[model samples]
Target: MPDFADLRERMIRRQIELRGIADPRILEAFRAVPREAFVSASYAEAAYEDRPLPIEAGQTISQPYIVALMIEAAEIGRGDRVLEVGAGSGYAAAVMSRMADTVIGIERQHNLVQVARERLDRLDFSNVIIIEGDGTRGCPEEAPFDAILAAASGSHVPKPLVDQLAPGGRLVMPIGNPNWVQHLVKVTKAEDGRLQQSDLGEVRFVPLIGEEGWRDG
Candidate 1:
């Protein structure tokens, strides 16, 4: 097995840094979190290989570059509260927790919720919490988040997510049909309650299945 420390640094240098993820804090957080711990033991050696890998459910851990890209786009701060939809194995949530004050990761899969919760707990990520629920609805009880990131792709930004954003907050997610080429988009809510959007780039993601997301999937 490759030394994860060395592989992690290399990943940061090549996959993240070279790709233009410039936030120093997010970069350090990516390097610090043990991504291998978030995946199964079978793929532990390939954890830092710069590609998405399958997890317990029919879900996947997003590639390192995409995770870095979304986090950078969100413009996270040490005091920000972040919401992560489709928490999966909790790798992205763990990374966000390092930069944000609190990160709530929502997933509909009960097994994934348990797995992710355990991983976050074992890693001593006190500020990251994993919840099992319909991610499309967002966590209204913890509404008005400083930043929101969706790990899966929907046809459009879920209304519940936009409604939950704090003033001047950013929400990042992939938008497209489940079987087509999707694009990553950044939606920013103005202080006066308006929403602005920008396209990051094309991306491929699993369908965000839930109320307010893809109905058939």
Candidate 2:
């Protein structure tokens, strides 16, 4: 077994410090979550490294810096309800569970959803609920989320997700084609339901597969 304490220190330094991710809340969440627990046994050693790791169902856990950046961009607050697309191995959902009042994560792959649920349950993260569905549509039953995050990259922002956001809610996602580069965008819904968009930076992510997302034919 690896020394989780030492790995946590390294993650703080390399992933957060060197990347200029300065949010204290993000740092605290990263430290509080045991990333190794969400990764495959083969990739546990690389959990602290600032790199994306492959998980089941051809999905990936985003790099720590990207995770922190997205979470910070959403500006999650205590008592907030968050919606996460692409649950993957449930690492990001687990992190959000620590900071938010409730987290609803949707994944397209059934296998990944099962794995994620098992992992979160093992860690006793009851605030997170994993659903197997098309993430591009968002979770209509759990509408009016305070914040929405997409773990995969899409050619455009799905309108369904925007509709589900509560007033003043923020949605963070990576937009671009799989064969090209993508930009990380933040969308905030105003009280009157108008949406404002801001481009944060460039990012590359796996394609989001769903009704509103790309078809994996």
Candidate 3:
């Protein structure tokens, strides 16, 4: 059996911490969730690697470093409600649940939704709920999220997501073509409803598909 705990520790130290992800809460969250459980048994050995792995529904889990980067960028705090778009394997949501009061993960694929829900439940991550729906349309019923993280890349920041963010909320997502390199962006909604956006860096992600996003290919 692989020493998953040791592998996880090495992944954190080299892939995440060495890259400057210093939030204690974020670090602890990574430690709390078992990444191996999120992927299939065939890919379990690669779970702790610093790369994305294929999950069900033709989707990919975000790399651990990228996940941590987005979570850190959102600045999730205790008692905050977080929304995660493209919750592929529920891994990121599980990690965020450790820090946030509640987390809603939106996955468009039915199988992925089932997989995520099952994994989260089995692991006792009760604070996270995976819903099957279009990720471009943020969950308005549970709007005013303190932090929002979109794992997929879109041509633009969907307006519904911005509209759903609570004043003083932060959103981190990638913007650009899905087939090409994309820019990771952070959008902050000020208390007075003003929005400020800053570029995080370049990244590649699956297309954010839905009504407000790219049409199915």
Candidate 4:
């Protein structure tokens, strides 16, 4: 068996840390989660690699660097309640669970939701709750999230997600066409309920499908 722990540590330092993921808590979170557990059995060996890999139902897990970048952009705190859209294999949710008090992950596909929930539970990341639903709608019942992140891309930030943010919450997502380029954006809601948007960088993500998002094919 590969020394997954050692590989994870190396990935943190080489792929994550050196790439400018400066948050110590995020770094520690990256080290603790077992990436191999979230991937398919056939992809176990590529789990610690710096690149994204296929999961199920034509979905792909985000690369480790992109995950770190998005988390860092959101500026999650230990006491915050975070919401994750497009949970996929639940790897990002597991990592976020370590950096925040609680995390709610939403996925559209039932199969992906089942995979994410099962893997997260088996890994003992009890702080994360996976729900099968439309991610673009956000979780209104759990509204006022301290931080919100989306793993998929659309033409713009969904209005529903912005509405669900706490007064000072931060929302991070990739916005643009999934077939081509997308900008990773961070929107911070001020105390006055106004939004300040920043384009973090360019990224590529699967299409975010929902009512407020791209139409499902």
RMSD vs true structure, all candidates: 0.9, 1.0, 0.6, 0.7
Query: Which candidate should be chosen as best, given lDDT against the real structure?
Result: 3
lDDT of each: 0.93, 0.91, 0.95, 0.93
Residue 148 displacement in candidate 3 (angstroms): 0.7
Specify the poorest-scoring 10-residue window by lDDT in model 3: 54-63
TM-score attained by model 3: 0.99
- Candidate 4, residue 21: the lDDT equals 79
Candidate 2 on 1-217: residue-level lDDT in tens? Answer: 8898798878888878788888777788888889998889898888888889988877789998899999999999999999999999999999888899999999888999999999999889999999989999999999889999999888899999999999999999999997788999999999999989999999999998888889986
- Candidate 4 lDDT over residue span 17-44, tens digit each: 9988778999999888999999999999
Ordered from best to worst lDDT, the candidate numbers read 3, 1, 4, 2
**Weakest 10 consecutive residues of candidate 2 by summed lDDT:** 15-24
Model 3 score (lDDT): 0.95
Model 3 lDDT tens row, 1-217: 8999999999999999999998889999999999999998899999998889999988898899999999999999999999999999899999999999999999999999999999999999999999999989999999889999999999999999999999999999999999999999999999999999999999999999999889998
Clashing pairs in 4: none
Among these predictions, the greatest TM-score belongs to: 3
Model 4 alpha-carbon miss at residue 128, Å: 0.5
TM-score per candidate = 0.98, 0.97, 0.99, 0.98
lDDT of 1 by residue, 50-160 (tens): 799999987899999999999999999989999999999999999999899999999999999999999888889999989999999999999889999999999889999
Candidate 4's C-alpha runs over 4 A off are none
